[model samples]
Target: MPTDPRLTRLDENRVRVNNPHGIGATLFANKEVPVESGAVTELIEMLALQNTARQFAKAAPGSFDHDPEILRVAVTPDFHKARGIPVGTVLATRGYMVPQAIGNDINCGMRLHTTTLRPDDVTARIDDLETAFRHIFFEGGRDIPMTRGQRHAMFTGGLEKMLSETRRVGEGLWPLVRELGVADQLDRVERRGSLPAGRVFGLSDFMGEEGRLSRDGQIGSIGGGNHFVEIQRVEKVLDGTVAHAWGLKSGTVTVMVHTGSVGIGHLCGGHYRDVVRKLHPQQLKHPDNGIFILPEGDRHRAHAESFWDALHNAANFAYANRMFLAVMAAAGMRQVFGDHVGYDLVYDAPHNFMWKEQIDGEEAILHRKGATPARGFDAMAGTPFAYHGEPVLVPGSMGASSFVMVGQGNNESMASASHGAGRMLSRGESMRGFDDEFRKFMEQFRVVTPTDLRRADVRQRPDILNKKLEQIKQEAPFAYKGIGPVVNTLTEAGIARPVVELVPLMTIKG
Candidate 1:
């Protein structure tokens, strides 16, 4: 086991760290340099693999090679090396794609919705806004009413489709939401924020079953884990060009939702793993890696196609999920702010997943895990925002500030950017470390509390709400790194430029 798991820079071109996974990988350094830190238990395995990867990078393509380009890739220090792979690992290949490279959480992503109200206006109404957000968010509840056509449109063409249809009525309760900038996000989203036409069958049977059983009649709903729906007000705008394109301005209120295909992605990943396991049982000798070797021919082809379709379905689900949340936010704002809080869909996108693209003139599948798509300025060639590029939402956990950035087209990065201030500690870590001070910090930001709702449930049963409110207080801003630094780093790296810094007034998490 690693005695010291900290990452340390050894030199300009090399770094050293005790392997996070104590049993895998062969650690190595250039002969001129030296290994500064490593775990004795697995240094042999780690060094050997590193040498093999380096050699593969220097050599031409060969049979059985898993994307030598992945070997040449570089990652930031915040990215921890994994058991069989590494977070931020990049792969460009024609031979075969590794499912684990993209990951189980398909289409996991972020969405940003803008509002006319500035930070001050939101601050003024924080208490009421928080009450409304709580009902719209964590309660797994909805207060807004939708007609049959709106429901159909939400599932079919999403918000834009609904908006176009609703414009004729002009009496739609949440017209102010149309201004929140959702239309602008359509072109920037993958597949124009629509589900791939041919991949519906790839969706998981489990997810289908669950969706059918869910009380909420929506396919694109936010699920558990780090996923959250936040009402934030833009505190600052760093890049005028990008900010204007994203419809963001200082003091503007925004709603950002982070979630993905949810259980569907998990279902897809689990299904593929079972198929792969059945094909090659030997790989199970080291199952922790989520690594599986696919056999040749039709079997491999089927697995790949099904996986691709599942991915597409999840991406679509995420797109719909964000749209649903945005719609809800619009309705809530209209009731509270009257016609003053106009909302617009600034940008919506998934930062995690795999897609086939031409990078540096090479046709390859780009797998982004905890990374956003940053295809430069010209990347969105066929979309409405093609000239402006895509808007990237980098959230900073539950209670921290979130960043709105525009893609920079860094070719070396396979046109990618970081997803957020990537987790410095696991969820369990936070649960264990949370103290009274942290609890107090979270309480300071919490604007809403269901006194009557909690009492009603509590009167019936002592723990009816299961201490959800109390547990939520642990996820304070202090638990996360400063968003300002993470944004500055991304901007410095030319991966993205910050458009807005949004401070959270109310947050909902599951």
Candidate 2:
């Protein structure tokens, strides 16, 4: 096994020690960067295939990737390099922020709903159910109508706005939010479904759009790339008590929705990328640069506030998107079996984006990309699902099994775990290699995409389906690492424990 020279094995779960300028360390309460410092370019030599587990621990404290705002950094077992940083990297920042840390997918997260229905509910009527799902997301079956004020409120106000929208437009939300009891369902949602967003400027212009007067133009849409809505069956309950309390029973059905802030997240990330880049004009000269930071200071106060506003707006929009998508999926199911059982919210949490939390007595800002905060049971005492710990959705690639685990609150993990089986192959690489693998997946699982029965014209043209499949080649199941091993690592690392294992029955994507 290859070992990382930069890190000291604090234990099996922890990778510590680093240079202030090289590979990073965990944030300390005192205002100081922990570990030794080193050179940045020396950190990268390039890899041929999947990244080794020690990639995050390879650099010293002051390595090329170091920043003053970054007090400490840790990588989960799913650690893999991203554009500027790496996925599964957890950074503890004191009075500083990095946009790359959160990436463009503002509030990219997962929402899992436990349904009163079971696998048998749709098994016999699989074709009808698939048709129904296709209609709601792609065909004319999408009936969600958002009023102007409700749209402004949602984008500017986050979940609070959604609450008001529910009152105005939530009457027909029966099979989705109504059956679950909206009040109770909303409580289990992260931060009750909203986070405070910085003020969204020119909100009025975006509101009165002809397509809208509500919901920043893309409310009921599912943007592409690693995003999906899948129907899964809980095949096994790993922790009986936790699964029971969370309404997850063996044979019970679920809808797992994963996506982000859509165009909003990209817009905010793009604006700040240039801003951060310009902040460190000197650093831009470095070959391995692009990473930048924003600290709490008078000089850059406005930039910080505006960035948060944009980031939060995108994040809230994402929360709304996932909620709305669930409604669409439920509507499709209802179309097939009139008056079927409804699904209740289990837990909703974001994997991407930056947030502040008090960890180990220090007010630390965590930039968690491709990581979920696994708050242990104690941190969730007052919450409804507190007994089971925070609900986490770890999705496998298309047509594969996804696992639902609960946070174990490993403070050393910075309260985070893998979002999914980290991508082993890049999109371009997968497009080149996944032909045979994709065929095998098609034979085994009920894979549904927009090119299916949703569009009559596309259905007629055999060529379109083939074209669409090629377009989505990047997300082929073989393109990612094994989901089983990733979950095993989390449990062994003491970051999270599995509650229920979910096997996908049907999947729909862009």
Candidate 1 C-alpha lDDT tens digits along 313-432: 556656767776777776667667886666666667777777777755666566666677766668778766677666777888677778877787866556676676654544556666
| Model 2 C-alpha lDDT per residue in residues 140-177, reported as the tens digit of each score | 55665666666667777787666666663543443355
Q: Which 10-residue span in candidate 1 carries the lowest summed lDDT? A: 23-32
Off by over 4 Å in 2: 1-67, 170-180, 209-217, 281-287, 453-463
Off by over 4 Å in 1: 1-88, 138-185, 195-199, 202-220, 281-290, 293-299, 384-388, 447-466
TM-score of each predicted structure versus truth? 0.75, 0.85
Q: What would you estimate as the lDDT of candidate 2?
A: 0.70
For this target, which candidate reaches the highest lDDT against the unseen true structure?
2
Clashes of 2: 23
